[model samples]
Target: MDLNALDDFQLVAAHGGFGRASRASGRSKATLSRRVTELEEALGVRLVERGARSLQLTEAGQQLLARTEGPMYEVADAIAAVREGVATPRGNLRIAAPSLFGQLALGTLVARFRTLYPDVEIEVVADDRRVNLVEEQFDIAIRIDPDPDTALVGRCFARDRLVLAAPPLLAPPSGDLDEVVPVPAVVMPSYREGDIWTLRDRAPRLLPRPVLRLSSLLMVRDAIVAGAGVGLVPQSIIGGQLQRGELVSWGTRGGDVALWVLHTSRRLQSPKVRAFVEFLCDQYPDKAFLASV
Candidate 1:
């Protein structure tokens, strides 16, 4: 099969259609259309459905797409590898991480990365929603959950403990979590499912049952500091407050969370992506978060 044609197909899918792909790829629409047609003929399958406005991938096309994408990326990586040898890490590294972390935690790291690698461009996407790595063309994603898929590379950078806390005055006495926890509480959107909260080593507990619920951690932290209900927050975000007496621990304690960095193995092979990942692992010092965990 022709790799250029495959590239065209991938570009079209990425850009949402042939016309858009042509504009993005710097190729004329007619030229890109012909190339895709040639690719379809070579593959002996109708890869894209013809329509007046938009293009959709056929079932066979989607299957082929899945199987070919990894190899296509590998091919690009190999070409880039040869063109730009190891010493300099230069390219766009598209990274996506949890909104709060991206906005608050990564500022310093991002600044240092740019200082160290002036040639590299960092595009950070702050999203609370999960991103589809392949379809979204992201080079790196920092996810808080476990990855069941083995195709992508997933490594735990650090472990963060969840703490139940609130302002010093409002916090209940620390000894027994059961009696102390029922004081009003603030929760993140992701925990809104059953309205039931469960603690490690304890049975599921009911909510509204006692406290207020919130969607954003920023808001939760603000509320907790303002003497609002207790909140369950990552120790990484609240450790300083606990030390300064701005916040105090409440409710149950002791659940550790894995901060996983996810990316395709192909992306790991790229020098730019590899450099950034190594920089994150080495410079970010997971120990600070782990100590509190």
Candidate 2:
């Protein structure tokens, strides 16, 4: 409520007159008088008695000054706190991420974050299972969908494309996942053990090589690199191995999923969380592991 007028009246009382308040506050006496007059008019009460020489506060002004001084100082403190939080990102940031990303690229991401914000501490949990971010107190979670939980705040930064990868020793002449089905092979972090890896965005009859499922994507990749078999896996995790000649992708017909960076409602506002999310958006704008590494 007309805080400028309240402050002007307070200044007038504190320094004894508009002339003295003008000198103290560096505001012109006319401006100070105008603010005080507006305050009194807004309040529907005369807060001060104007005099030729002596200036005196009325009961209303005295009561307001008594009641509002503490609250105004609190407002100032709150504003200062928000400003400081915006300027600096310093805190413990806990993250939950997909096991494959953790094994393949999270190390580099964490290192980059450390270099950029040395004061922030990073803690990460890598698991295929999606955790309750709020219950676990994680600042962020990474997911590849079709996930059921649609409640979190998130941004999709990259696509997790399925690559039909195999080591050169076991490379199929046909260059098709279905053609390699007779060979024993693998992908981990699977929901079920089956030969039917469905191809979407295309004909339902198309399928990947029947995967001999392992427990983790890393194990599946390692088995493939060691010449075990061809299996469908995310391209983000296998880009390095493909480049290094340890593994080669047959290339898939479909089965690409969007990678999301999800965060809790409360931590979404934090400077550290916002900074990391924005950095992820910039760093990944594509498949991050393939793009960066």
State every prediction's TM-score relative to the real structure. 0.62, 0.69
Q: In angstroms, how far off is 268's CA in candidate 1?
A: 7.0
Worst 10 residues of 2 by lDDT: 198-207
Put down candidate 1 lDDT per residue, 1-293, tens digits, no spaces. 78888888888877878789987878988887898899989878898897899999999888988998898999999989767766578878899998877766677777788898888888999997888888999988988866587767856777777777768876343333343233466776566444545455543342433355677777787888888777777777777787888997654555677777788895427777777877777654752353322
Question: What is the C-alpha lDDT profile of model 2 across 1-293, one tens digit per residue?
Answer: 68767877888988878999999879999999999999888889998888998798888878988998888778778989889977788889999998777877788998999899998999999987878888888989988873656568878877767777878876454334344234456755553544454444322232345456687776777888887787777777777788899897665746567788888664438889988988888887565433333
Count clashing pairs, candidate 1: 1
Q: Against the true structure, candidate 2 has what lDDT? A: 0.76
**Steric clash pairs (candidate 1):** 185-211
Which portions of model 2 show Cα errors greater than 4 Å?
Answer: 1-9, 18-52, 56-78, 132-136, 146-151, 171-181, 187-194, 197-213, 264-268, 286-293
Q: Identify the candidate with maximal TM-score.
A: 2
